[model samples]
Target chain A: MEPQNAREKRDAAVEARVHLIVFRLGEEEYGVRIDQVKEVTITPEITRMPKTPSFIKGVSNIRGDIIAIMDLEERFNITSAARDSRHTYTLVMEAKDYTMGFIVKEVPQSLSLPLSSLDKAPSFVQDFNISENFIEGIGKYENRLIIVLDIFKILTSDEIMELKS
Target chain B: MKSREQEYKEIFVAEALEYYDALSRHISELEKTPEDEQILAEIFRLLHNLKANAKAIGYLVIADVSHKLETAFGMIRNKELSFSDEVVTVLFDGIDMLGELISNVDGAKEIEPSPALLRNLDIIINTQTDNNTELNKVQKYYTSKNLSLSDLIYIQIKKLDHLLNLVGELIIDRDRIVSISKELDNDDLKNVSAHLYRITEELQYSVMDARLVNVGSLFNKFPRIVRDIAVAEKKEINLEISGQDIQIDRNILQIITDSLLHLMRNAISHGIEKADVRKKNKKTPQGNIELSAQNDRDTVILRLKDDGKGIDQQEVRKAIVQKGFLNADAVSDLRDTEVLSFLFEPGFSLAKEVTEVSGRGVGLDVVKNAIDSIGGRIKVDSKKGVGTTFTLYLPTSIAVKGALLCQVEENFYAIPLMHTDSVLSLPTEKLHEVGNLLVTDIKGETITVVHMRELFNNDLDTYNGTKTALEGDVQNIIIVTYNNRKLGLIVDKLLRQQDIVIKSLSRPVNTIDIYAGVTLLGSGKVCLVLDVAAITRYFIARR
Candidate 1:
């Protein structure tokens, strides 16, 4: 019976092990799943596409492959530097069959934490949210709120089809 | 693997498609009317704009191509280069290449322009520079003429659409005053209400008028299309456009451009006979195709009339029969006008052999579909060996107001009064079943009655007791006309008529096409606006 309880405890620990990649946009801390993140790099040249949604910055060529870059400031409806040099960074992610780059204010740091740390996002987030689809959950770390993002939901299938079309 | 960068790339791809379309038209026009300085200036402006934007976005391939086009235009403007048929042809080829590049941008496959094409472009650029002496003279001439050409500003249509939507909401808010006034009884309040009403009316009218733009902007490109087709067909044709100042909604104008282009091509390729044939027929040696636009009541009537050998009824009838759209017996009964209308039927083409211009079997049918998609009707009038005039009657605006309110399943729906012909009361005894369709007689006319519940797919019986109380003594029957046929719609009641702003349903609620849009009533509750024609078509198709 003692061996059986030990096995259950091991399984529980495995379930609790969840990793998040945290990033900053202005002053806010945001986190996405570690598996969803492909890479992080300094800002690169972005080729502008005419007549795109306002949030889309343009396309970028990264390591010989063409990828689209979306302005995180615009996507999050935040007011940041229109084009800042020192604060610029690119978050490379793979979601919804697209390899895209997210232009954020700074580099992201990977964090390994227990799933029990996450809690439901406050009602205020839903009321004033620009886009709630990509948000998975929220967690508190060091007196700051980390917005967990569902990268899969951010790059939706419909958006992929729209791009293809 | 999709990333944020890929999202931006897609945006670029969508924008590139629009720019390419403009570029192609500009190039095609330049080919035929190279001497038109204004057209050349426009071309230069468009290319320069594309290059600047492409560079800003980091689209190196587009930037490179546009840069070359801009340089070529710059040389032309300077008089260093003169227009040639070969040059224009090369420009057209370049435009086509641009279109391919844009299409590839969104595709999963890697995009690379043909090496041969790039080499050819480089050679053309080098050749232009070699002839800089002539280019300098051209530039001097342009300066002497006092023509100042600048790059065009590129704005997305969505931004304009969003602005219009906000204006529409403002108009709706202005109308809400009427509902508020109904609850007040004071004399001062009455005086203020009257003033508010007048101001709101003026605001609504002016805002709507602001959205109206001259269709000529779109029509201007067609002359070049006609000229190209005429040269290819070895025919002498003169194209005339009148009433260029007639205005319509910009949204409707864009949809009509493709249809009009197809029709214009058809006229040049198939409608107009060869120069010799035209001379033999006692018509002008140069066949004339006149496109005229005018307003008739609330409808905008656009006519494309060509002085050519009219549609041969027998040939059309034969094609109709071959296509199986009509039986032999039906063909025999059809009038010449009716037979001519068969050209608009899908997959029906009378051309003996397919031509590059139009014989793709989709031209006329596409015109019909385009017109129908915007709730417009196409009418054909033809005289044997004389001419054919295709008249299109379309509503000037898709954003309709002054709707007739009707109740169905305890909910009220607004049906645009323009589409609602007449309302009649159906006596219980007169309503009889005719081949599973309820029929009612109105002044010797037999009208088919479509139950509102079934049409909207509402879960309520035709004569539910609760509906009777709301309806009162009169059994409401709305008579609506679709494609010249009258259909009687049975409703629970006829509510008060008001000018309500139409709002589009969100994607989730728009699966059913019966509701053209949704609008908020005075009480702020959302009510669906029934698209009467779409509903009729749905019923007919289902049947």
Candidate 2:
């Protein structure tokens, strides 16, 4: 009975897979879940927001909500483009109680990868300044490696506090 | 499946509290007039409702308790048992037990009725069975045909708050439309804009009206609190309330509930004197305490007055000195009003010993803090050996305000009209240089001039100096009073006055206290509503 129960547990583990929404930050491609993507649109004019980290570009007036726009390149250690550049789109993402925008170089696309295709992020890839907790196991799609982003773990509570304070 | 049960239990608990409050109210009425058939029937109906609700929720223990109480009430309804205080008190205890049983459904596990409580309820039943007339006395309540149409509907507060938020957004859009129509200068667009403005204004008023709640609902609870304290303290006191019809925002009422509780407790614990002391002082042994509310303009004034021993400034002074809060020399120059304000200072309890009721001096400051949080002020007045009255002044609503628009450089800021005294163009030549600061004379009073540019202190550097009002020789000054002192805010222009919906600055923006909140101006630009009191205090402290 014990051996059979262990075999079922292994089967469940093998079946675990994460569906993600992949987007580009400069030359790098990253993936967050499609579930958390509320909208994808051209980055509009943003208000000059203060009391936040430099990674926070500004606030976007979407409908009536004043959502913060986080610059993904600056957040993930890629050199930032000029904020007013046209080569950018915003992904309105949600995780638990928080909802904010992520500015990426390309429009996000949805995809799913099985657990068998995923592997631990290479030590060099994890060397970015961003918190490694948000870097889920990496996978390859169409011969291009995609880094999975854990939406809930991307920004630490302390970082959110800085944006609010 | 397990989590579903947890959600149901939460619903049952919330509903049970409302039912319990209704039961307690109806039962209290029945106690006073036990022979009133209507009151008895109402109490029975309330119990029956509780029983059926508990049974449906699978809280069988609570249902059993309610059933037992319902049966006893049925016997009384048949005119079999004589109305007595002993019976009323016993049933009140039973109701209390039922309350405990309802609270015990914490969603963690199934619970059973206490065997001891069941036996106690059984004993009451057996004692009353001797006079039982018939077993078929299920009292029929007032029929549906006899029901009066109640105009009141209770919605969850969150719904109204959400509606208010959407209305706020609509108002912002309306202002943007008005600005656009004025720019286009088209008669057709202007006509539509005028109609839209009128309808939008009416909607704002109607929504605020829906949120208004009568102060009486809160004041009604005070009599019971006073009665319980009076009985416990062995004192004879009467609480006479007037202006129970005064209505204010329900949010403000809920915020001040704890403050009122503290004040009432203090009234009984310290404000009212003992019977012997009253007799020795050649006064009536029975004391009178009045709780009243009156509306003044857009503000509500709640005054709780007790004709007990008024506060003694000498005793309070000693406490302040003893607490080492002030030096003896410093305390000597304090006025009676200033000394009275000291009672609200923390660590200054007048009660010599800790009592369950109050008097540790910890609560008075809490009362002041609570009132302040609701954008209200509390003032205490007492004449030694006569009486003490604490008056609370609260706003009708905190969401919207009529404000005077003012410009500092190019930026627009709002000053609440309630605090604005008068706007004047003071000639800079007439302004006397008192040391390093500017001062002016208005109506034979010295007013400190505060430069908005300097007071706001370049917090929003990007928006700095876009519009300057100080280009002329004369400075535009708005006279305002805070903490009995007058200060003048120097601005470049004074725009038209209008009602603006204020939104609280959530974070980083709130760190700058110069602005009370953020509002969208008629031109669609975000404006900060100034906190006059804070600016006044900050200027004075700097001086």
TM-scores of all models? 0.53, 0.63
lDDT string for model 2 (B1-543, tens) is 235467556667777766776787888888777778998888788889889989988878788899988887887888655557656655776777676566657647644555655655565566655444322221212111221222234699889888887788889889989999999999999999999999988887788777888798899888888899998888889889999878899889999998898898888878889999989988889888999999998889999999899999899898878987777986786667767877776666888777777766565878876775656777789988998999898889866777899887666778887668899998777676665456788987677776676544433232222223235678889997544457888887888798888877643334445567667776766666787766765555444
TM-score of chain A of 2: 0.77
Interface RMSD of each: 17.5, 5.0
Summing lDDT over every window of 10 consecutive residues in candidate 1 chain B, give the lowest-scoring window: B135-144
Distance from true location, Cα of B242 in model 1, Å: 1.4
lDDT of each: 0.70, 0.74
Q: At residue B462, give the lDDT of candidate 2.
A: 27
CAPRI class assigned to model 2: incorrect
> DockQ of candidates 1 onward, in order?
0.02, 0.09
What would the per-residue lDDT of candidate 2 be over residues A1-165, giving only the tens digit for each residue?
579989998888767866788987766688887777888888876654433467777555565555668887887677654445555789988756556788887667878877667777667755676567778778886697988877767644455654432
